[model samples]
Target: MDRFVFAGRTCVITGAASGIGAALALHLARREALLFLVDRDAGGLARVAAQAKAAGARDVATEVVDLADGGDRLDLAAAVEARFGGTDLLINNAGVTLSGSFEQVSMDDYDWLMEINLRAVVRTTKAFLPQLLARPGAHLVNLSSLFGLVAPPRQVAYATSKFAVRGFSEALRHELAGRQVGVTVVHPGGVRTNIATSARLSGPDLDGQQAAAAKAFSEKALTMPPEEAARQIVAAVESRKPRLVISKEAKAGDLLARLIPGHYWNVIARVLPKGL
Candidate 1:
């Protein structure tokens, strides 16, 4: 498939304040795409908007909407409809991570992460589907994680949410193929995001060691740059690829999952770093 042109295309990206979302906004702006950026962090959103404008975005709109709330997501969609009529691309990039085993993580933390990662994706996508359908050559991108493909020791809540996203993206892709809309499920390995520092650590070792370990794991194992991940995501959307794995580690994990199926835990336990 030919690369889909972003010039004059309307793109809405949730969680546009930082990390992969911010990088995607900048990259898409450079491509001359009209951008609607949304995030709960008003300050971070402003900074990204300024950078996007400076990067050559002709039309940029930003909103401080928390996707965790269904009402906020609907309002965001209304705002998009009011400003640009509709969007050609919807990137579901906002998500949170919880650090701990299933037993260690609290039910409240699990619910909170699930609300942001899975429920928000569903709500936001549903809110924008009408607009996407009206536009020609629309694309949907959902961000899953490498953990989604292969579960490790910790991160039970995060993995569960990502696994759900992966399933949703797959089913939606098949359902939308005949409707002129494409879906791409992204599995990013690490990509230097603040999710580590901001993650809720819930273990007995919460004296700060768990948080530090997560940061270290992200820095060492998840080394892909956010900008690079954004570029690849855009490319995948353009090419209409069904699945896009961002890093070498992510690719390896996917392969391992496919080969091992029900036994990847054993392999991962042996291969993963001792501290993590």
Candidate 2:
């Protein structure tokens, strides 16, 4: 397989323990990039690191840091700089999920989700972005969701965070355009990652609703494999694409949102089953 010219780059991927992060790390390893894998789960990060090294990473390492903690993210950057000098690619892939009515959402749940989903992106980017700018043609990848493009019924906090991510990515891209940094905002549709299975749903009496949504979600959706999504994202950066939609469904939804504006929500509304 012909790989992209990522051979000499130092790639830092957050949430690298599993899901798309692990897959991206694996793909980049095949392209011979140096990998700095970050995740709160130490054991999972170790597994990803071993896979990257086995696959073909020039050098592979791991950092166990909870991105939701601002102080932890700072320490993580210090460790990265201490170990690897500087990064050529920084991917903000760490995220969490929440589902409930905005009014029913607890303050703790709201704050925790915000910290992980939105604030961590800001913190990690601020920490690693300088290293990226110092190098020529550096890259930054922010993993926004299809929900970020359009609002849905249940995911109140998650939607707000993704919206922030989408806006931040665009703004950062423009700010860094004339400079050497490149920013690619990724919007992936339903991916066959364990995120849904592991997601935390809130609301005092919403457990039944959550279970029903989970069931419906698994049924009607065809989640593309994480490997395929990872490939699309890496390819986008190599090709200098500013915005990337990982699945055909995502692309269609994005286009529809653009074409009819508010009507996109109507489509989603119609698609929703009773419980979800």
Q: What's the TM-score of each model vs. the native?
A: 0.95, 0.93
| Residue 185 lDDT, candidate 2, scale 0-100 | 96
Enumerate residue pairs that collide in model 2: none
Give candidate 2's error at residue 104 in angstroms. 2.3
Residue 247, candidate 2: alpha-carbon lDDT: 80
Query: Would you list the C-alpha lDDT of every candidate in the order shown?
Result: 0.88, 0.84
lDDT of 1 by residue, 101-196 (tens): 788899877888899999999888998998899987888999999988998767788999999999999999888878888899999986888888
Q: Write the per-residue lDDT of candidate 2 for residues 124-217, one digit (tens) a residue.
A: 8988877887878888999999878877777788889998999999999999878878889999987877676566777655448765666567
Point out the worst 10-residue segment of candidate 2 by lDDT.
1-10
- In candidate 2, stretches whose alpha carbon ends up further than 4 angstroms from where it belongs are 1-4, 205-207, 272-276
